[model samples]
Target: MSDQSRLGLINENPIQNGLDAFRALFTSICTSRNLPSTIDTLRQLGVEDLRNLALTLFTSLRNLPVSGSLHSTSGSATLRSVLLRLITAVASDSFDFDRIKPLLEIAISENTQDAQIWDFVSTAAAESTPPPRSIASSLQQTPCSQNTSSFVNSSEYRQNVDPVLKLELEHLYVGLPNFHKSFFGDIPELDMVSEAVFRKCTEGDSPLFKEGWSGWPAGAKESDVLTWIGGLISQLEAFADNRIPTSAARRKLLAQPKTPLEGSTGKRSMDIGFVDSDIIYKPDTTDSRYRWAHILVVGELKSNPKADIASAAWIDLARYAREVLAAQDTRRFVLGFTLCGSLMRVWEFDRLGGIASEQFDINKEEGGLQFVATILGFLRMNEEMLGFDPTIVTTSGQKYIKIERNGQTECLIIDEVIKRAPCIAGRATTCWKAHRNDDPHNPLVIKDSWQYVDRDEEGELLQEATEKGVTNVARYYHHETVRIRTDDDVRNNVRKGLDVTKATNFQPKRTLPSNVGGTVSRISRQGRSSSSGVKRPSSETDAALPPSKRSYSASPTKPNLDVLSNRIHRRVVLRDYGEAIYKASSRAALLDALEGCI
Candidate 1:
């Protein structure tokens, strides 16, 4: 068709002429070969128009008819290539382009016709502009460095992240449940630290009050505020130590202000951390001082009390939580808090995501008591209450995991950690090479991962495979869904008086075109276990599980509004087998291993 005819078609039936209109615009840009003119044309289009045009073009490219003529396919490929280049040229800091790039990249990667287009566009775009600042870069100017993996640090990580993994994290973050009360509600610890303790500590005659906090001066620096808070915590810690002599054995939770925690590079540091007093920290030395394992709780401080959850302070807190969780393998969750001036909120982060307490001001008597209770609660918590998995124990410099089967118990000594999940909020799978305490020579593999409550256990599938006489598969010994008191308590605490109508709806507003579909089918194939022959539940059944499992009996309101996915901790033991194929001694050995597996 002529250009005039294409334009006429677009004007006559804009909705129906989706592909044709896209083709015409694409052809004009390609034929003109004028970057400035193309940019001008793009500038003239409204943001919505640009978005709709990009979506329509992507949809057409992705859903091209299989039975179409070769010429038509070739034409589509050429059009796609030109459009990608055009997008690269015009890509900027604009909201519309930012949204379009990721979706366009997804389409290009899925399309086999022009798989190289992504790399070409990426390189071209990089040459055009300074690389976009990542979430990490934005916070680099802070007093302490927070950079860890590119996954948390840089925007470049987004380009390479597995789509399913990205989706999973997004789901967890969006559905992350937050509670209005403290993690420990009205515990004996609160009563132990009476309101009198707070009043006495901050009284006009007290040393802490002389330093600050009696009339906490306006425009006080964060460091000064932190020092004043530290004094109160220290007084409480000392009081606990005197009352409960055994508390000393658990190690003193000392507040370290502006000190870099040991784990990652020394550059990354938290504003304040509660660390064990037993460790001799040399802050002036080049080496890392306080280990993440020794750190009990992390805190972020902001001079501005108005800093909300969306502020950079909270973002930094979230990043610190991930770092702490990643560093401590035994940790099931991380406890943190944000002190934005006098406003304080405690946070708990697990694989499901984060839950935050309602913010309370520390300047008031009630808030001061709550603050004292919070510190006392931290001190009173046992190892389990602090989010440690009791089933995994350390004794005599050896780590052991207790696995139970049919009401019988067996201990496995963990020898080597084979793998650990890199991210904080997903399955967080960890694998270990272990041996039964009774039979020390033979090795077994223990796999620990978090699974959705409704999903089938891996042990069941392995048992099925063994029963069916499947060859070359590991033998299943035991599996258990781990039940931790803290997890249950967290759920129960959050569910109390939770009004579903007040919950924020995080479901995405835009849906992929029907023909284009989603990544579910692709993820299923990638996520399948080696025992692929094992039958699994249908998609309809899988779809039904979330709603049914997420529903709360207490709430008559819409349950879907509170959409957090509750994941159960699971561990399975299997007979050790072949090594990683790449670890084979020779190429021939690798081929033999592969053949046996096939």
Candidate 2:
């Protein structure tokens, strides 16, 4: 049709004309090679006109005959592409973000069930290819960085908005069960610490149990959680003393060796420890026979569900393990647990063996009470049975500190032990994403190409990561600190010197899978066993595990970039760490300072 004829169709019966003429007019627009002029024309149209155009395209798509001629179907597909391009041009116009924001939302809200539209919109929004400098660039300039509020409110908001949109749109397309799976997800259950162990989810603030209770509580503060855990530990101690129950088993418990559990209150730094654990079981320093007096059990408590556990919990746990591994007098394993309300993760760190028995939530073991009791029992058992030789202390130990932007704290540990230990040694600098299709049942795909990035201690990128088929540079940002450790750390811990008997005695009765948590309907006592009955990570598990598993094969087929951008991949980004390193010093001053030092 002529340009005049198309204009007449719209002017005559705007709604009907739009629906009928959409395919023909859109095809013309796509072939015209005049997006610049079309964008100008779209900019001049009022909101109603834009809405009519979007509605017409959507209706045309929905009403298209399924068994139409191939030529007609191909034409419809081409028209759909043009409509997508047109919508994108309008949404990302070099005007104000607020100007077209409503129109975009209306289009999305009206067609929530339209898969093709969602796919198109999401891909357009998450386009990793940086667009020409628009409002985002101006707001992201160096000057805005000085003002956190201004930068976050403007630049960060716009860039971050698209990712959220992509997620919501995708969620609209999945089944309810899959949606729930995606929502709750799975967390590893550690032997000593797990969400399954803590019972009494509702009751709170009772005496002795004072302000005491169990299970994950909503709106509970950090201090409140500490109080509940303290009470729980005291009750456990009393129970082992035959104080809580009057059954025959109570006396049997009293006959077992007793290990005191202590929380941080007014203990000295030298006596209490190096790391600030919420609760610790200090070695029986009063007794001279034990030889080593390092902190035996270190537990750090956190309440913020939104905080980055990979960094805060994982890093601090590794730091504590490192300290124990390097202690001048101790070569035995130090137990570490991070408790976030009902969520619990556990690790065992030793000088020779390294760190092992990593578990996420053991809340199923009698609500974690049994897990704690087992841990205490292991500590009470004979050290020789547990494979501990107190005489084998490392004489030449070195000291290192967890370098924080705030400051630093000294950690005394065995230098050689760290070289061989599977301990978390450093932070991640650069990152990459890859697909793992080894498991036909649960194939892992490259969801998001964007990576959380930061500079290492030596100012090097942590990730040299790339995704399949993405020729453009992936989006990268720095954020929360995640300590880097691997399955080798587990192997290292086991090899150095693990007490097979003791590890078995301390293992929880029931071990939960690594990726699930909630009310425990039934407990399965099918404990995993090694030759020693001690729980050790399998080589097969390491080989299949995504975090530690690396593939060096040639890159596979590239995915549809737009579709790939909308895949479910969650990442935590923190403030840039290198900002300070490069801030005050310039090239000239640094050269002179280095020259003077040399």
Candidate 3:
């Protein structure tokens, strides 16, 4: 009797439960005695079903949460055998390497040090009598020092085996950067090194490029293209900033993988995260030390047009934008770009405005160098302005910049309009009881510095906004937006507009700057501090759900305002003392000048 029969899972009545079904499939295909029967069963399902089943098996391995480690997992032995058989089956039939190779890596990733798994994969690859005609032809034309036997024997040296992937694997195992580069000995500068490579690839002089005008080699594997694109971007990184990496070196810089809140314990692993043009911009802060990096720009590079990959790439970009918005309370301009040799497309994602994309030929005028330069400009801005150490407070507060002139100290607070009523179709500004330092007792109860963007009477967009009718403004600006305009602008405007002596004599500064750049400078203060009971939610939950469903608020319930007001009172006393000191300095200065005359 078959194992299935013994288990009471007959051919007609299979295991109904998902978990049991997978376990049954695993045991049946993995045992040596039942391997032929399993293959025959797959054959009965036809070639298409077998191909799909092969893919499903790979996905199952990826999604399965292994306990302890891959080796220690209960069914790991069965999984290993099943994977080996799948590789043998695919290679023997000359199945698409693009699909098969990624699946093989799933096994390699589980236990990278396992020599048996590597041996099986390499041996199966070698036993394949004939590769696809396109691959065979390309390989025949390509010049290599090693013969076919040697090529198949050395896994690392195989043309299809990506060195960068090996670098990623090595780093994943050991905390080393660019570990694979050690194998290459020494190479010249990329500009000089890439010239020969570029010529060979473009001219079809080397077998790496297909005949006529195909961008890459005939039957070029996905890894081959990704490795090439990664190399290309690595060269471009030198022109941009050394800290911003574009290759496997870039992946190393990412914060340790975080578990998603949606209950998927496995870390996020997307193609864009590895090889796509996306650049992750991390804030330079030691305050919150979870080395999370934000996706500033999403760029995808393709050698050939695969609609599925392209669509998936865009979805990844969109997902990245949402995650960034949830983490930081600033406006961000998430950019997207795709390059397929001469063809290029540009995209932008605006939280309120929606996303837009434009496509053009990079080889044509107004595209090539300009497009590259624009992206580099974005990278430069993200590194410098957006990626600064930010001050995070649990409660609503205003950052005060203290300025002094001739011993007369002036604490400049940007005055903002608090919209008592919400705007007709825009965001609302709320009253913020800013704490004196972190002390809620000394509150400088004030309005947010937000100015509405309005269209002119002509219905055209207005460069300058008027405060008369406008009430709403963006609640927060992303770090990227903060870089463009800063809180200093508010200070500069107030200082320049008023004659300090006259403004002091007539009245205290009533209104702060309506809008300030997001950057807040550090200032020192002394007082007992209290924080609001508000906490930002994790991005994982926000990422999984839609914009409408996700909650960004720290607290689900309303805050006690009466208690807030009393706590805010202490901070006000500190502000009063500061103002008194400024007045005393002015009087003392006047007395000193009189004494000098006498």
Question: Pairing residues by index, what is the TM-score of model 1?
Answer: 0.62
lDDT of 3 by residue, 209-261 (tens): 33232343344344554554455444445544433334322321121223221
Ranking of predictions according to TM-score: 1, 3, 2
- Candidate 3 residues lying further than 4 Å off, grouped into runs, are 1-223, 238-270, 273-292, 300-312, 339-343, 361-375, 382-598
Q: Model 3, residue 120: what's the lDDT?
A: 36
Most lDDT-accurate candidate: 1
In model 3, state the lDDT of residue 91.
28
Model 2 vs. true fold: TM: 0.27
Please, what is the TM-score per model?
0.62, 0.27, 0.30
Worst 10 residues of 1 by lDDT: 540-549
Report the poorest 10 consecutive residues by lDDT, candidate 2. Answer: 540-549
In terms of TM-score, which candidate is stronger, 1 or 2?
A: 1
Worst window of 10 by summed lDDT in candidate 3? 563-572
Clashes of each: 1, 37, 21
Evaluated at residue 55, the lDDT of candidate 1 is: 35
Model 2 local distance difference test score? 0.29
Give each model's whole-structure lDDT. 0.51, 0.29, 0.29
Answer with 1 or 3, whichever has the higher TM-score: 1
lDDT of 2 by residue, 319-388 (tens): 3344343332223345445565455544443322223232334245443443453433333333322323
